[model samples]
Target: MIAYSVTVPKEYGYVILAATSTFFLNFWHGTRVGLFRRAAEIPYPHPYATAEQISSASPDKKQAMYLFNCAQRAHGNYLENHPSMVIAMLVSGLQYPRTAAVLGAAWAVFRIIYAVGYTRADKQEGKGRLAGSGFWLAQLAAFGLAGWVGVQMIMGQA
Candidate 1:
């Protein structure tokens, strides 16, 4: 077995903060979603408001649930992509901490935009495409950087 070591860059503090802030923001968003869930009267066990739940609700209830589902989805979307994005940021950070930090910050900002846009949209049409426009780009950048870093490491040029 071979053991490998990586030196933490001096600029790594920025990367640490960026990554930690993502978790902080995600947790905060979940707290807000919990409150929203209560306001919308969405009960436990149901991950989302089903079509039947929405259709059977009164107009006001329907609106509340729709909006709550939007919030939930926004949070859920963040969770879905979280593992890979964070992992890539950390992995790439080994060689390019500053770039990783910038990418991480961009991701955090875009995710916020996506969440807010999703929560405010009246309907599900396009799924907040406008708000999330920058999200995928940032995510891809982090992923790409991680792949490049791995390649360079393997080539013994990192």
Candidate 2:
């Protein structure tokens, strides 16, 4: 038998937690979109098809179309925002781990709220949408703070 020990910097603890949570949230949204697509009998490639096509396929069924739209938007929003979140979290973690973690967690929570609101209303522009925007702004702030800290560190001021 062999034993090994591993260590992580304290600052990174929250960062890891935040990142993991965000990843799971993204996965959940993706899976939800998949379920919607399956329920609608929309083919794989078709799910990724044009909006016109998707709407046309489910014409005369407002609720079904709304469900599909919600799922597609959820997945699309995740894909669009996740990359920036990853980069911001990584950079911020190196310097402002706690801030990064808090913002990252907030982002995930806001995204869920946004999804629920969008699904229920079948439209954007609401409290959930506002929260999502706010969270994204918070993330950008975290990234900016991290950049500032990095610069300060390089200048021997941090």
Give the alpha carbon lDDT tens digit for every residue of 17-129 in model 1: 88999989889789979877987898997777889998999988888888888888788888999899999989999899999999999999988888878777464653664
lDDT of 2 by residue, 41-91 (tens): 667676544566555764535455557666687668778888888778877
* Candidate 2 Cα deviation (angstroms), residue 140: 1.6
TM-score for model 2?
0.77
* CA lDDT, every model vs. true structure: 0.85, 0.70
Per-candidate Cα RMSD to the true structure, in Å, reads 1.9, 6.3
Alpha-carbon shift of residue 137 in model 1 (angstroms): 0.7
Task: In model 2, state the lDDT of residue 109.
Answer: 82
Candidate 1: TM-score? 0.91
**lDDT (0-100) at residue 151 of candidate 2?**
83
lDDT of 1 at 149: 96
Write down the TM-score of every candidate. Answer: 0.91, 0.77
Which run of 10 residues does model 1 get worst, by summed lDDT? 121-130
